[model samples]
Target: MIGERWINLAVPLALLAVPLYALMADEPFTITLATRATILALAAVGLNIALGIGGLVSLGHAVFFGLGGYAMGILAFHAQNYSPLEIGPLTFAGTKSMPVIWLVAVIVSAMAALLIGALSLRTSGVYFIMITLAFGQMFYYFAISWSAYGGEDGLSIYVRNGFPGLNTLVPIQFFAVCFVVLCLALALNAMLRASPFGLALNAARQVPQRVETVGLNPMRLKLMAFVISGAITGLAGALFADLNRFVSPSMFSWQLSGELIILIVIGGVGRLMGPVVGACLFVALEHWLGGLTDFWHVWLGVVLLGIVLFARGGVVGLLTGKAGPHV
Candidate 1:
């Protein structure tokens, strides 16, 4: 238990170095690599709530992620075009600040989640997964067919989104935002796990019948958790769109959804810091393997197969044992 605590504490602090190293590293490739890894980890953390704790096993989380990215992209486009988004009667525009983009991302993703969860939560097991995946594909196709924001090609931003006090375009500063957000997500996960609501959610995951017997509607609890999960993942998506200064349908694809699951499995399902560690290891492996061979995914597949076959609990589980009961 003490070892677990130490690992838990050490992991976040160690992650702080990612931005610093990226800034000071001589190689630009390494810096970009770290930046991408941090953002991906943030997305995985959001998925963790639904998959790890709620046991929802949603295969279409990419929908929320893509929604968040498109939020950023759409807003940035409007802002650049200096055009107002005309609603029924209210005309809206965009801001250059990151906070504004993040807020919009959260709201949009939450609303989408509420809609999807309402429909999808009506089903269970394979049906739920299929419904979620179907929703994700719907969004993916919409993005591809919609020509407003570059359609299938994608939309790019001339400048990185700004923060009040930092140079958003600087690699280190941007990475710091990603790292800090990742830390915040982990902290929030820990807090939620310890909260009463989190306990109920976890109980629902283990035994919905028991949770329902205790006067809690498992569906209500799961739906709430799903909304929160989608909002968090959407925030990560906003940052991701900014990281690439672009957004495309690819962000909403089933492949992206699968990768998010792979992150959880590789790190240690239900572990707060698992996504972070998994993201780092995954990025490192991809980098190294890519340097060695053109078909790096072939090697990555082999490695992932090994982990799934030999490692029951993933990297974090191997290092720190099973997560606590709450997790």
Candidate 2:
């Protein structure tokens, strides 16, 4: 059997190779599909940090995801419309720059995580899940009612945000952008998982009492993990919006959050490359199977059930002949 580390390395390289092949084959749509997988993988990576490593089973991650999308949409929307964004006494101009939009997305998502986690982290078990879901639903409805930015119908950005030295309008170039960001996010996850803070967070998840006895605040650690997760997910959301050139209330839907969890679950929780593998599988299934039937979700559910009952380690775990640790 192959080592999981090798499998991990192969997964990312395979993702990269596919799009490169697509580019050479003049398959622009394939590149787009790969880019979508990359962004979803990035979002799952964020959730892995929280639910996988930190044991925070949140269901409201769509809040951060939608916020990130809206951040980019609102900024690009204003830029294209030749209007300024006004927040009370302060007046600011919108930006079409990817860097600027990403920064705003990360900061806003992190701040929202802090506030939501501060409250939600106080609860445990199913209550935490419910509260997070409630928050997600709240945002979903709010986005629907936000008529300024197209409200329930969503907002569209006519132009893809500009990235320095890259022609984002080109499919391959845009994919490169998402791929690079995904790699960076993966690197961050790797470092965070192996760091002292990660160990502490894991400890808090595994045994809060022991962590507390050691003069550490478990809640604080969890909160930080949640914030980091949100920031990464938010960045993915921004990229996703750019990919589609649109943002909608559906971005905040509970279904999106559930899918995020499914990606992690199917990929293998707590593993560094779990989300990547999961996202690839999901996109592949969605693309290929979806063409055959509208009830692809039923197949997806069957797959999920099998993974839950027969192979708790997920795809990665199965390949390595080991079931990974559950959250």
Candidate 3:
């Protein structure tokens, strides 16, 4: 409990300290790195809901991430081109508003999750994993074939999307936006985990039969969790695309899905700060080790292997011992 309390306090302080130092040093790149960590952490937080609480191992979560990215790219592309988007008989003007884009991303991703979960939830074990992967691949190929946005070339935003009064082009300002969202998501995760629904969902994951005997529908619970998870991931995807000012089919790749899972595992499954720690480590490795060697992922693999074999509770567990639920 001591260790957990320290960690719960330390992670946010560390996150705050980075930006302060970067701002004082006039190093915008550091702020950008921190923003990336926050965004990736946000994505992992979404996945944590499904995997940690719901015990749903989805290898296709990237589909939602990519959907969010494309949502931003598509809207911004049309806005920049000064053209309206048309679908069927309806005509819509493109928007560069971040809030609008985020809403679209969440709604689209949630709808996709509902449809996918409705079918994929029918199976269990490896079958569910494969089905999710297949769906992800389908979206990936569709993105590649969809030439209107960029096809295999990818879409590039001419400018950062608008945010009411903030100059998102400023690295620190953008970082603050992302950081605030991460905190809110973490808060929501805490609320959800402590709610009755969360308890039932966790129980369903561990013992579906027991949950069923309690007159709860495990499938419905899982589906709701999956949809919420997708929506959050989709929102992260929108922020990510905005951060990079680019969107590509690669966001839908299975490797990305694997990386999101890795983030949670390396940080600590079911811990609120797990994704935050994992994202920080991942970004640091990608920056430092990546500069030294092209095979940086090989080093990441080594670290992951060590964590899996020795530190199953991840960095948090390593620091806190087997403590209570990480909040």
Which candidate has the top score in TM-score?
2
Instruction: List TM-scores for all candidates, in order.
Output: 0.95, 0.99, 0.97
Q: Candidate 2's residue-wise lDDT over 170-251, tens digit each? A: 9999989999899999999989989999999999999999999999999999999999999999999999999999999999
Candidate 2 residues lying further than 4 Å off, grouped into runs, are: none
- Each candidate's number of clashing pairs is 0, 0, 0
Error of 1 at 137 (Å): 0.4
Off by over 4 Å in 3: 323-327
Per-residue lDDT of candidate 3, residues 24-61 (tens digit): 99999999999999999999999989987898999999
Q: If the candidates were sorted by their TM-score against the true structure, best first, what order would they fall in?
A: 2, 3, 1
Prediction 2 global C-alpha lDDT:
0.95
Write the number of the candidate with greater lDDT, choosing between 1 and 2. Answer: 2
Off by over 4 Å in 1: 323-327
Query: C-alpha displacement of 224 in model 1, angstroms?
Result: 1.0
Pairs clashing within candidate 2: none
Model 1: residue 202 alpha-carbon error in angstroms: 0.6
Q: What TM value does model 1 have?
A: 0.95
